[model samples]
Target chain A: MSALLDVQSLRVRFRSLGMLRALVTRTPDPFIDAVCDVSFHMRRGETLGLVGESGSGKSTIARTVMGLTPAHAGSVRFAGDELIGLSSRDYKAYRRDMTMMFQDPVGSLSPRLTVRSLITEPLRIHGIKDRNRRAEAKRLLEMVGLGEDFAQRFPHQLSGGQARRVGVARALALGPKVIIADEPTAGLDVSVQGEVLNLLARLQEELGIAMLVITHNLNVVRHITDRMAIMYLGRFVEQGPTEEIFHRPRHPYTEALLSANPQPDPDAQLARIEIKGEVPSLMNRPQGCEFHTRCPYAREHCRQVAPGVSHAGEGHVYTCHYPLNT
Target chain B: MTQASATQPIEAPAGAVLLEVRGLSLDFGSSRGRVRALRDVSVSVPRGRIVGVVGESGCGKSTLAFAIIRLLAENAMITAGEVRLEGRDLLTLTPRQMRDIRGRRVSMIFQDPMTSLNRVLSVGQHMIDIQYRDKISQADKRRRAAEALTRVGIADAESRLRDFPHQFSGGMRQRICIAMALLVEPALLLADEPTTALDATMEVQIVGLLKALQGELGCSILFVSHHLGTVAELCDDVVVMYAGEVVERGSVRDIFKRPGHPYTQALLECDPGRIHEKTRHLPTIPGSLPDLVEVPQGCIFKDRCPHAFERCQRERPPHYPVAEGHTASCHLLDETRGNHS
Candidate 1:
């Protein structure tokens, strides 16, 4: 089957300074590339994860995909239709098919609006008036395992987990084919985090909706995603099957991340690979390989030249001068 | 209400107890009513050992840390119990006395590194200012500050000290926080969710730094965090709290391998890292925490526990010995009622 969403060599840039300020400062390059040459596609009902630290441009990709942010280069095709440079009205038609769950659940919800209005607001915005709004709210709430009584309560009245459920209910209201969830289980208790993960998993399975899960938590990516991409300095250092990446990561960054992830088992021997130095500023990116400054196996060659994509196995690719597990 | 002797038989694990909280019950005057924020909570930090207090939000873990440091809010009332440090009751200490002991003897590492440090002051100034009580030359204080910064792995510590908190990254700021906290060489360090705000890589670095520093400094650390994996990895002993009560306390291996409390078991089971197989539904503990305003009469976790019996509702269970250094507060651990399941 054809991929539901196809993105090729996507790049996003944001102006660091105003035109006048840039002229005054004599800045040669006034723009910073938030995302650079990132490419990936998602098949129908396939979950893809974007794993990265803060300022890694994972969220920017989500924004660009939703047409919320403008992409500087490359193509983003949704169901065979070119999405870039589309009119706002034209983008509105695709909005029903693609939905985004923002990072903050409680903050994303309007404080004044009740849960009932919050969930049904999408339908009202989309002009889907055939169904009873109240009944529709109840149905959506039930789908997310929230009861009918929650409809009357405001966002503040709900717990972190409940607020997340309400957010899910709202996202599912329009019955989007692709859901971009950014840090869906963040700021939740362990038990509650599980509930949110499970609810998302069940809904994805039952509804056959593709997911783009962006989170720093490796465990979340490992548990839910089919295919995963590791982002560093706004580029995919490694992209492949989730299990393959977890079991045998080819990229040094991917290996460091996996090793650094704290396993719950106390007896598990932890030889954590500590990535030295802070994440370099996006405006002042490195000369050659962005991660060479901190990469344990970085050589003089790695410092002088950028590495191209190297295939490890079928569907597993890593960009590294000396990929591990060769 | 008789005093609960929860800390009676904590087998003195290898080292001497540095700080011990006994039957520490605290209440806050909330809008609704008097909220029982903490209920007979007791845990001890052995010298040179990392004791991790794990719990969800509203479970009073942070409050425990604050209470140990005597930094509770004005409305908070310590109705019962004592926070003893080195066999002395810290609760009875005067405000001036507490102030003297706070930074010099029991320093704290707050969750948010960005907000904790003064944004206006340079890292060097903050470090130098913290040592105001020391009767030393300005140059000597600055030299010592540089050494502390260097110990925490900050490169070019002397030069970097001139940069403000905003100049450093989140990981570097946290390292500075750790450095500042350890500068005093306090007997006890209360690190409340030190790595929660950090990224995965930074979190691992901070944990590793803490482990190494604890070994070198020989200072006890009370690490309070909701992250189970981090606790399992960094802490020597684990204390599980639920709705303001310590449900279980054990060595890291005992708690992870053989959790007696249903809450701990459920919590461990629900950890995404523990689940190797991808499933449609992840294990979860059903029901929300009990209301703190009108605190439950019996076991706080009874409403949510799957193995809760009639006895759990009638009376609160005491800490039952599971092993040499492990204890769990649950009715199922009651040998008198054999095989409650």
Candidate 2:
């Protein structure tokens, strides 16, 4: 199948300091690249996970794909239509086929609006006035496993899980073919996190909609994603089938990240590879391999020269001078 | 590392009791009414062992930690309990005596490092301020502060001490918090969700540091967190709390391997790490926690338990012994009653 949503050579940059401040400080470069040459594609009904630490540009990539953040240079095509440099009016039509669910469930919803109005706001935004909004709200709520009584409730009255369900309802109100959920199970208890993950899984299976999951939670990524990518300082360190990467990761960063996650089973043998130091600042990124500063297997060559793309197996690729388990 | 170990104050014998709470029940007088925050909660931290109190939000895990350090809110009333440390009842101590014990004998690490740290103060200043009660020289105190920072894996400890809290990253700030908390060489450390605010890599670093520090310092830790995987990895003993009550208590192996209580079993099954298959639906506990404003008559988890019977609905279940040093407050384990439905 052809790619449903494809992003290639995507580069996103942001102003780290004002021009005046940069000139006063004698800084040569004011713009910092949040995302650098990241590429990925999703077929119809596929789920792709973007995994990274904080400030690794997972959300920036999502926003850039949504056209909310302007890209420095890239190609974003959805269903054979190029989305880059499109006008707001022209983008409105794509908005119906691609919707985003924000990270904070409660804060994303307007406090003053009732659940009925909140869910149907997308329909109103697209100038769809023919359908009954109250009925539509009920349908959306039912789709998210919420009862009809929740239509009259405000955002504050709902729990974190309930608010997340409402957010899912709102995202589905437009019947988007692609849903970009940023941390769908964040700020929820273990049980509630399961409920939300299950709901998303069932929804994807039922509607056959492609999903782009952006989260740092590896367990969530492992459970929901078919393909996964690891990001370091906004660059794709590794990308492959989820199970293949989990069992046999080629990149040292991917292996360390998987090992760092605490397994619930106490008997699970842990061969943890502890990475040292903190994530490097985007402003002062390392000269060569961005993760070499923390990588355990980093050598002198890795510090002096950037590594090119290396393939591990079918559909598995990593950028490392000496990939692990080769 | 050698210098820090030489200054260890007390070497309590292994397997000796350090802090014990017996039948602790607390109530908070709120505008909505008196809310029963904790009920008959009991836990013991043995010398040099980490006892984790695992629970969800509103489970009174944090409140139990505060009650231990005598830092409860103004309106919190401890109706029934005896908090004993080193075989002496701490509940009978005066405020002045309690103040002395707080930092010198028992220290705490809160969830958010930003709120706990003073923004305007330098890291060295905060470290020096915490040692006001010590009678050591200024140079000795500074040396100890730098040693503590170094022990927690912070590079350039001497120079970074001059930097402010904002100068450090989230992981470094939390490392500082851990360092400061352990500087006093307290007998018992209360870490309330210390790594919840950190990233995965950072969380691993912090957990490793904590394990190493606890091993060297020989201080008992009452680690409270909602993350089951973390508790399973770091804690030696486990106390599972639900709706302000300890529903199960056992060694980490016993609790994780053979959970007797239905609530605990359900909680373990709900963890994404435990669910190995890629299924359309994940298992979940169906209902919410019961209200605690009024004293509950039946079992706390009766509403949500899958194995709840008539006996559970009519009366509260006592902590029934499941195995050696393992107990669960569930009627299903009551073989004497023979009334499990």
Candidate 3:
């Protein structure tokens, strides 16, 4: 089967003002490479977990794939159709087939709009002038586990979980084939987070919609994601089946990330691997591999030269000079 | 400090309770209505031990922290409760008395270090301000501030103290906040999600620092966090709060091994970390938290609790002893009547 979404050699760079001296001197502008040389693909009904730290370019990749931010380089293909060079009109049509769920539901939904209007706003924007929008909106709410009476309530009137359901309802208004959810359950309570993840899982199984979940929490990916990709700086350090990545992470960065996560087991003596030093700033990215500065098993070659993608197993791929076998 | 010094064993308790909160209830009063932020909450921190309070947002964990410190906003009123810190009633203390106790007896480190620190002041100035009213001289204050900064693992503490808050990274700023909280060597340190804003590596570092500082200072700590793993790793005792009420309280082993309350069990099952073998679906609690304004008369968790019965819906469950030093507010204890073997 063809991939639902395919990205190749994608890069995103932002141009910002340099130091005061440089600004006064009108020196050449410097660019910060937010996402660099990233490539991945998602099959239909498959959930790909994109795991990373705060400045690791995970959200940038998501935004770029959704066309919310234009990619500076590389191609994004959806079901054999190239989406990189589409016009605004064509992009609107493409957007109709894709949707994004943001991390903050309150920020995503307008406070002034009622739940009904918020959910149906996408359908209205897509020029679906049918009077059935209200009924469809009610159905969407019910699908996300909200009652029909919720249609009359505003975003502020709902709890965090309820607001997240409204966000899901809004995302599903156009019946998109793929959903890019960025940190969907970051700040929610554990139980509510489970509900949202279950909802997303059921939606994927029922609708066969491909999902790309971006988050820093490894636990979320371990449970809900079919495939997982570990991102460091602006690149994928490891990509494989979720179970394989969890059981046997090859990359040092992946190992560090997994070890850092607080396991729920009370007696499970977790030997936390403290990666020394902070993440290097994007403006002054280290030479060679972006993670080389913090990699525990970093070697001279890792500092001097970047590692290409090396196949670890049938479906597991990792980029590291010295990958861990265990 | 070297690894050997850092790895020194945390001293055993001196067998004295340092802080106790009993029957604490807080309500926010406004023209709209009264919102019960907390109800009949109680926790005790033995000296030289770490007690973790774990709950989701609006579960009143932070409110409890603020209430203990008497820093609650004007809209919030401590309807009924007693906060006894080392045998002195904090609730009965006047503003002037509380001011002396604030840093000298108990200090709190907030979640967002950036907002907690003064943006215009240098880190050194902020540290000095906390000690200004003390009998310590200016040079002594600077010396103590530098010592505290160095203790929290900040390299080149003297040089970095002159830098403003914006100059520090998220992890460094959090360390500064910890340093400020520790300047007076309070008997208790309340850390509210100190590592929430930090990344994974930084979080481990901060946790390690807190553990090391606890060993050095021998001060009891109330570590409030939503992350269960952190609780298991750092705290000796754990208090599980739900909807501003203590659902379960016990030693870390009992709470994790034999969680008495259904809400505690659901929370553990909902955590993604517990399911590692395969991609099993997480067991979500069925319903949302009850509105604080119109809380249900029965158990706060009855709506989402799978084991809830008619009695659970009609009358509030009392905190029953489940095991030695372990208690849970649930009707299931009644089901196991007289079987507390």
Q: Rank the candidates by lDDT, best first.
A: 1, 2, 3
Residues A103-163 of candidate 3 have per-residue lDDT tens digits of 8978888989999999999988889886597789888998898999999999999888889
Ordered by TM-score, highest first, the candidates read: 1, 2, 3
lDDT of 1 by residue, A156-185 (tens): 999999999999999999999999999998
How good is model 1 by TM-score? Answer: 0.97
Question: For residues B182-276, what per-residue lDDT tens digits would candidate 3 score against the true structure?
Answer: 89899999999888888777887898889999999999899999999888888898999999998888889989999999989988988877876
Clash totals for all models, in order?
Answer: 0, 0, 0
How well does candidate 1 reproduce the true complex, by DockQ?
A: 0.80
Instruction: Kindly list the interface RMSD, in angstroms, of each predicted candidate in the order they appear.
Output: 1.2, 1.2, 1.5
Alpha carbon lDDT at B321, candidate 3 = 74
* CAPRI-style class, candidate 3: medium
Off by over 4 Å in 1: B1-9, B338-341
lDDT of 3 at B130: 92
Each model's Cα RMSD? 1.6, 5.1, 5.6
Could you tell me the lDDT of residue B148 within candidate 1? 98
Q: Identify the superior model by TM-score, candidate 2 or candidate 3.
A: 2
Report clash pairs, candidate 3. none
**What is chain B's TM-score across the candidates, in the order shown?**
0.98, 0.95, 0.93
Pitting candidate 1 against candidate 2, the one with the higher lDDT is 1
